[model samples]
Target: MKPTETDSTAVDWRGDSASSPDVTRRERLKETYEARVRTPALVAWADWRTRFGLLIIGGYVLMALVAVLGLWREPSTSQAPRLLGPFTDMSYPLGTTQSGVDLMALVIHSTPTILILITAGAVWATLIAVIIGTVAGYKGGSVDRGLMSFSDLVMAIPGLPLVIILAVTLNPENPVVLGVIINISYWAGLGRSLRSQVLTIRENNYVEASRTMGISTPRIILKDIIPNLMPYITVNFVFAARYVMFASVGLYFLGVLPYSTQNWGVTLNFAYSNGALFSWQAAHWLLAPMIAIMGLSLGLILLGQGLDRVFNPRVRTRMAGESKSTVADDDDDTVTEVF
Candidate 1:
């Protein structure tokens, strides 16, 4: 049927009206998404706990750097001045041990030992955990049962007593060997947790979709699954570091690894053996190593907590409540809720 010009014009205007609403809706959605992303990164960084946690970590790094520089500088005959009272001589800042070696210098030298132990233990534990977990989780049934049994076996043994026996058997004079022994004590529980997480992640729709696309199992696990589990791995690593240090210190304290290779535990061992524990004058000697251990552990704990807030929705909400954002959606039911 032939139409009048007015009718044709009216049909064209109706077509435009139908399309306008959708385009406007899409634009609105795009703007909202952009705002959501940019706004949260800024707010998350500005949160007081995040700042406080970062500050704690930053202080530890600074102390580590100072210790490194102190080690790097040519050996000085003139020792640092003791400031912490009778526990140390006037020449030494923290004081000297019964051997008359500067506690400050020993502490500075020991930073490398602590760093090496933590790094070595974390690497081995993380590697073993990720491999065992991903493999067992992705291949269930018999494989899962076997791995779970193995994890249980490892967990059943008391850790410190075993570490002491092994450290004494190895009779480690080197920090690296000590670290490896310590790592042996750390990976099992982490592996079990990681396996559980991977089991759940493998069932995710995106993972199934990838599998349907003919992606190989290993590739899918590496690309699709492992990345999502990284936050959990990081949290475990922080705890692993503390655990390794605790084990190392336990060994040294128990007289299992007694040689002083500038290790803090060795320093504490020497201090305790020399009547520093009983004498009020030698308290700084006891205090120095204890403080370093405490500070390092506290920093890692707080950093782990901050990372939890960054990763876990539950912790994020608590942190956000403390920060108090008025416009931010606090509803738990919405998928779009950030924390």
Candidate 2:
């Protein structure tokens, strides 16, 4: 007895099944990579603003690392002539201060201190806001009223004056301590705003469903609620960092903070005190730190704006759909070429 044509074809199909698992495995890996890596990269790259912001931020970070690791010349070492105007010498591109401190080195070294101060202050403030906001919004009633009242009381106090008083009293030299002191009055407003957001989020169906379930309050807030609030929280963190940067620099400029040669604000103060404002030859001394401060602030502002599209549900969905369609079109073209 001979096999029928259909039976012979069936045998070939069965043999093909041996490779099916491998094909499926490969497909799963490809999908995971696309979803986790490629898609996100494309989404981020889609925005030119994000790219420019990241470029500026990366440059600052690189410079900071170089300064911290002593990859460049010591900023304190006076290796150049005093008050040499910028571009006068290739070695001192940014020129020299009245004391002959390398202006470029001073700018570079100041990067890490400013970055650390903002990061510490922002993280601390954001953490406090998230905790107080989430709890107050989720718990509501007496807890909400109590927290709101306290926040309002804190907000009533003048922020800058309080920071000045604290700076004078504590006289902190460490960036971290100064950051905390600077932002002591900063969190209440952000927390109140966040509480408003959480109030809306808590009323969402998914959050309500979690509440209906036997899920613990803490677990629900952490897992279900916080994730939804992340986009807002991230933007606010950047805002908080910017606030800290300005406050710290202002304090240093006012001579409230202990003098440090490495500080940009102190550099500004020195340049001013030495009459750099009136002297045309000393203009570079004043402009260097001002440019650095403005550049950093610009980067933060651009980054925050760009992150809105990346984290926003509506924007992300639209971009992701476009990305998928683009990928599909590419795949179709490839298949057409093969055929």
lDDT of 1 by residue, 105-139 (tens): 66666776787777788778888888888888988
Clashing pairs in 1: 82-92, 82-93, 87-281, 88-95
Best by TM-score: 2
Model 1 TM-score? 0.70
How many clashing residue pairs, candidate 2? 0
| lDDT (0 to 1) per candidate | 0.73, 0.87
Among residues 3 or more apart in sequence or in different chains, the pairs in candidate 2 whose N, CA or C atoms overlap within 3 Å are none
Question: Relative to the unseen true structure, what is the Cα RMSD of model 1?
Answer: 9.1
Q: Model 2 — which ten-residue stretch has the worst lDDT?
A: 308-317
Q: For model 1, what is the alpha-carbon lDDT of residue 330?
A: 50
